[model samples]
Target chain A: MAVYTDITESELGAFLRDYNIGELLSYKGIAEGTENSNFILHTTGGTFILTLYEKRVDRDDLPFFLGLMDHLAQRDVSCPLPVKRADGEIIGELAGRPAAIITFLEGMWPRRPTTAHCREVGVALAKLHLAGQDFPLQRRNDLSLPGWQRLWDGCRERCDEVEHGLEAEVSDDFAALEAGWPADLPSGVIHADLFPDNVFFLGERLSGLIDFYFACNDFYAYDVATCLNAWCFERDHSFNITKGAALLAGYQSLRPLDAAEVEALPLLCRGSALRFMLTRLYDWLHGPDGAMVQKRDPLEYVRKMRFHRQIISATEYGLQQS
Target chain B: MAVYTDITESELGAFLRDYNIGELLSYKGIAEGTENSNFILHTTGGTFILTLYEKRVDRDDLPFFLGLMDHLAQRDVSCPLPVKRADGEIIGELAGRPAAIITFLEGMWPRRPTTAHCREVGVALAKLHLAGQDFPLQRRNDLSLPGWQRLWDGCRERCDEVEHGLEAEVSDDFAALEAGWPADLPSGVIHADLFPDNVFFLGERLSGLIDFYFACNDFYAYDVATCLNAWCFERDHSFNITKGAALLAGYQSLRPLDAAEVEALPLLCRGSALRFMLTRLYDWLHGPDGAMVQKRDPLEYVRKMRFHRQIISATEYGLQQS
Candidate 1:
């Protein structure tokens, strides 16, 4: 567990003096993350999660993550609500790290989530898109096309050393993508990393959503493509058509995608897969040398990139003609 | 560009004093990583890439990365050979960062790598495993099983907040995987990141391999599984049996996998996918703010995870019974 900061029970109680969340009964470090230290705090009022930002996270971005949760909660997005301190500040300092307290959401992360669960998540994600429509914040997807090229440049030398011709091929693909990137689309806040582990459920229904760290302004349908790439695969990495249909149908039910958005699904999915492949490749090339955080295999995303590359036709993504 | 140390051309030239390489012609910053600053150095001797270790990479690991490259080169592995100083020193200090000079490989990364390309990569990877059979190094796959759980613990809270129920599912999967992990398997040096970007090609023939950063000791077949996950997927992130067959055949032609290895392929593939999914998920939850690095959609790996989950039958992975 990445414990950027450690806090004792008494220390946490002193920190919670400003919040209205009653007395802190107990707190323990929740071992998880590559960036921050997390503590599950049980108080007289209720349970809450206290996060202490580590080196990986920028101090300035705390408001965006915390504020988004607060905003989403106010809009009934079924997520953790950030608790502001008595000084009306949501962000605070704890254990020598930037910290914030959020209401502990009740429910469990589903282990055997079904296709129906995926569909529900799809619908919920669409709802989140809708709910975040008028959010006052304006953060762009900084890690989009340009960011990809930057990463490619960083690992280009070593890239060819591992796999033959990977650098040139990816460069060519990236050039093509850059040459013809989509311009106009229905854009809004996108939950960039809506993986199954980031969601909580009560049975087949989605109880809540968590982790708004990657939420940024981007094409809404791209989020759907991400979901399809995530929730519609069988055990052999084969596309599960039934699950795909359910997920798509569920998304369309809430926020009907524009024709342009639908048409761009395949390309977006490809771009999305490439985005991951590049990041994973970069990390694989230069992840931390430590016993704490393990380096990820970049090949998984490489497979995803190949799959997205195959999705040449719009129909392949089950989208109708624009 | 993440230049941990900003040195002038003269400073860099002075730093390259004892190297076998000739005078530096030019150096340009490659703005492309979260861990290190890379400069493509043009010298009278040849074009080389100079990497300056940044925050994410430990300075101590410089020896490992450099030594591994030297070892592979000595064993006839087509890799980027680390350049040593005239004083027989491989490590150096540049701009207050641990730095090294390495030969720049020539080739393109396959954008639309075919089944043939997959086969060649498989063969080369197998050969790499064979070459490393007696290497003096013994780096364990720290990212294998326990590392995943550690990451899960760090990101569990924000994980649910991001995707909903994904945390529990991942945890359960991790637990199940831990309970039945393969106790015994042939272990050796594996190029864990066998992605297309990591493989270099000079036309139809395989030229070289890059990115040995994730290379470590593990089941040799796990490397094959990593290749399959990377190279056997169609554009829609779906499995392609033809590609899979070619890749496997190529691997067998060089170093055939045993019965136990074949039987373990499916689980290893699943485990490989899960490893990536978890890491990507962690990055999604706690990506650095304003950094050039892109956070890959964790959902893509979620689909991959699902696919691996469905591979309950050994026959599904083209394994034959002994």
Candidate 2:
């Protein structure tokens, strides 16, 4: 649904002259990414994805996003590699927007993620974290605590419109999280939004991870928390512990969690839930009328927030003590 | 922008089992056709397009549309051929909708079509018409005179919401067109919606035609009239006679227009314009609020209708007098 900028044949022909990829056979505007225009470019060489960064993405963060993919792919983390131009720059300009072409990954993201899918996602995410440790670039996770607070403030007055008691419940949750939020967890580059839609799999085996736009340097445990919120919840907003156990066990097999990290897991889950809920709430209140981007209901995250609040230990999430 | 039906990985895997196509490698929802939900399916065998017919298209007409493409491809017309299932059935049920797979056609549609592109389209369209002459199944062109009148009746009251005096102008247009409507012309299967978006080009060569959903039994000259409305005008709504001449000459090279057909060209063009304008106006007035499908301005077609109304001869459309 994200074909905001239309690329003409002559313009695309001129643009491809800068790259060594073979003659352009065809290109299609794909309904893949949300915040940018994406086209599936076919050439005599191979198929690739062309993304034009829209205004929602910060221009300065292009290097960090594209470079992270480069670093991860180099480390054998299955992900797209940003194709460099003859000038050696990964980013180029097309249709008045910053653009880049990346190698097309071959897999479909599971629509209904199973327990096996959760386990594979956990392994892929940990591998990404380990691979990203040695990367030179850094980008602050802007959707962190302060950012959540700003988003909450923007939508607090109108949040009740989405759900009658949403505003007060979120306000109280914020106060609780602020008082007990973890200050010292292991930090690294994290795919801050590791939703099922962003992870691809060929059958049961995880093929690759995508949508690195939300990726940034943050507590790796926070990234894990986001995955827990995304993958372990059923349609009824009920936590599926078997899926949770599978996800956590798969991650711990790669990078074992410390005692301190285990204790902080429940609170981090609440924080992650808050981050998504606040953003969704802000969009629910302030998004332009009739936007093509379907609005994710903030109340879904609200239910997740409420579930996490009742949790007393990581054990409740089916995390086994090592 | 038309991914209305969400197909699960499991659903797709089960669906592909009925076909001879190899293992499913990947599938992505594509933004190609406006009405039906389309997904580009990549399998071990090859790439293909999976289309789920939405409510906008009638289910009964599915055979005619699929059969036409199959027939055209058999006769060497460059278009996507519908892939049949094991039971020799071309259509099947998926996600509560009728679905079919077709071989993916390679090439991009011209965004800013030139005179060369227009000529190529003319040649390819004529080739399609010739190939489809032997097509067995016949589906009536629902969006012809009666269809236009029905659409006009539905939107006439609120048509002024789009323009101040559109109702009166359109009424006069209807009176004139109905009186002069051709009772007979070179009749055959016609691609009623052969817009530039439906035609693909690889460089200057016309690669293929697509979106057979609007194909039906009609006057061949009426199809040409749709193309003239589609390709021979600049963005400013001014007719480009050079492009028009190239298109007509290219088409005539294959299927020469008879005297009666040539004489009815201007009226056919006017009818074509009114057909599109009425549909656009109806959609504009009655479309569900916040629809993802972009509503095209009826005013553009209104201008075209006005242009065709003044033309006294087919020469104005660049048709050569033999």
Candidate 3:
């Protein structure tokens, strides 16, 4: 529901002159993607996606994100590649916002994730991590431990407006994660937000992944923990052990986790859950009234955080020990 | 921005089992169409639009609207044809709402319409009217004069909150329109609401007209009046006579308006303006706060209503006399 910047025909026609894609046939504002405005573009040459980077996306980080997609696609990862303009620049300006066009991927993100979907996503996630190993650009994961602290600072006093004991619970979780946070692991570019909505599929097969705005350099196992929390949870907030086992097995088939990475899984899961909860809490409390952007309930992640806090070992997540 | 009903994968798959369309490759909720929830579905066979009728559209009117589209497309009107299910029924139930699939039309509605676009829509509207002549379905226009009074009744008290003297101005308009409303004129199935958003175009050629929820039996000249108000007004709310002339000229080239129809254009335009104003006012005053449905400004129609009040003859709208 994000068409914040309206592009007129003449403006679009002017913008398309820089690209090799032929004359515009038709274009529509897509109702997906929350962080930025997206449109499905049809041209005489081919179909593509036109994305206008909104205020939330940092303009300086555009090169890193676009370059990662370009690099990964070259390595045979199924993802949308940014289209280069006639001037060899991938980014352009339209309707007073930074905009770019990318090749459109054909698949729908699974609304309801099955065990098969979880396993395929785990395999795809491993492939993405391996493919991104040698990428030149380096972006710090800003939503990691320190970034979580900054986000928490903004909402500490008023956090109880959402849930009664949310503030103290979050504070305890932060103290535990900060003390036990792993300093070193196999770090690479991780799809930091590989939620089901970001991963596309056709039937049981994985088609591609999208919404790379959150990709950053981080611990690879942290990415796996994020997926364990995101994909294995049922609607009732209970973790499905079968889906968790499948996801871990699928990932281990490609690149098995070391002892240290496996040992850090529970804390990583709790930290990942907290990161999402903090952001959702911030948006829930501070989002403008009557905004078109749908606000997600932070309490869902709160439940996940509590579930992760009780886990004693990776085996509890149905991860088998070697 | 209207995806009021969310359809799950299993539900959508079950719904498609009743149709002959092949396996569903993907589907996305379209941000277009205000009256119903629309999804652009891609399948192994072809791409199509799936519309779930919302509460705003009467359930009984489904046959007339779907039949009219089927009727018009068969007559070479170039609109979307309703796809029939395996049981030979056009409508089915999905997500507890009446739903149907229609062949997808290709084209974009112009954001900034030019005079050439205006002329083409006039020609298309006239073609639509002629094509719908022999259609068996008969639906009275609910947004016509009587419907305007009913809608106005809900907003008359709070009308002043929108504008200082809106209530009195609208009351005087009702009194005048009731006394002088035409009893007998050329009548047939007319698209009561032929706004620019409902008409799609490829370059300067009109691709098609859509959103037939408002299609009903009414004066054909009144549809022409609706188009004049919709397409011939500049951003400043002033009438663009050149565009108006082009539209009337394009329409007359196909089906010339009779003498009585031509003479009644000014009042028809005013009545058309008031009809839209009343509906917009009702939605403006009563629409749920924080709802995704964007409420249109009722004052725009008020301006158009005032502009049409000063129009004395069809000649002012560039209608040439034979």
- Model 2: per-residue Cα lDDT over B1-322, one tens digit each: 6788889988999999999999999888887777999998889998899999999889999999999999998888899999989889999999999999999888989999999999988888788888888888998999999998899989998888999998999999889888989888889999999998888888998888899999999999999999999999999999999999999998998998899998999999999999998878877889833356788888999999989989999898888877
What would the C-alpha RMSD of candidate 3 be, to one decimal place?
1.4
Docking class of 1: incorrect
Give the residue spans of candidate 3 off by over 4 A.
A288-290, B288-290
Residue pairs whose backbone atoms clash in candidate 3: none
- lDDT tens string, model 3, A1-322? 6666667767898999999999987777767888887888878887788999998899999999999999999999999999999999999999988999999887878889999999998899999999999999999999999999999999999999999998999999999998999999999999999999888888779999988999999999999999998999999999999999999988998989999999999999999999999999999888933366788989999999999999998998989877
Give candidate 1's whole-model lDDT.
0.75
| Cα lDDT of model 1 by residue, A1-322, tens digit | 3444545444566788989988655454443455666666656786677888777677877777777888889988999999889999999887788889888765445545578887898899998999888888877786789888888889989987657888877877787678767997998888888876667765466878887777888999888888877677665667776777778778888887877777788778878877777877887888753233446666666676677777766566554332
Candidate order, DockQ descending: 2, 3, 1
My TM-score estimates for the predictions, one after another, are 0.50, 0.99, 0.98
Chain A TM-scores of all predicted models: 0.92, 0.98, 0.98
If you superpose only chain B onto the true chain B, what TM-score does each candidate give? 0.93, 0.98, 0.98
- Estimate, for each residue in A1-322, the C-alpha lDDT of model 2 and write its tens digit: 6777788988988888899999998888887777898898889989999998898999999999999999999999999999999999999998889999999999989888999999998898889999999999989989988999899879988887888988888889989988998888899999999998899998899999999999999888899999999999999889999999999999999998888889999999999999988888777788833366778898899899989999999999989988
* Local error of candidate 3 at residue A101 (angstroms): 1.5
For candidate 2, give the lDDT. Answer: 0.90
What i-RMS does each candidate reach, in Å? 24.9, 1.0, 1.4
Question: Evaluated with TM-score, which candidate comes out highest?
Answer: 2
Q: Go through the candidates in order and give each one's C-alpha lDDT.
A: 0.75, 0.90, 0.90
Residues B1-322 of candidate 3: C-alpha lDDT, one tens digit per residue: 7778878777898999999999988787867877788888888888889999999889999999999999999999988999999999999999999999999887878888899998998898899989988999899888888888898889999999999999999999999899988998889999888888888888788888888888999999999999999999999889999999999988998999999998899999999999888878888889943367788988999999999888889999999877
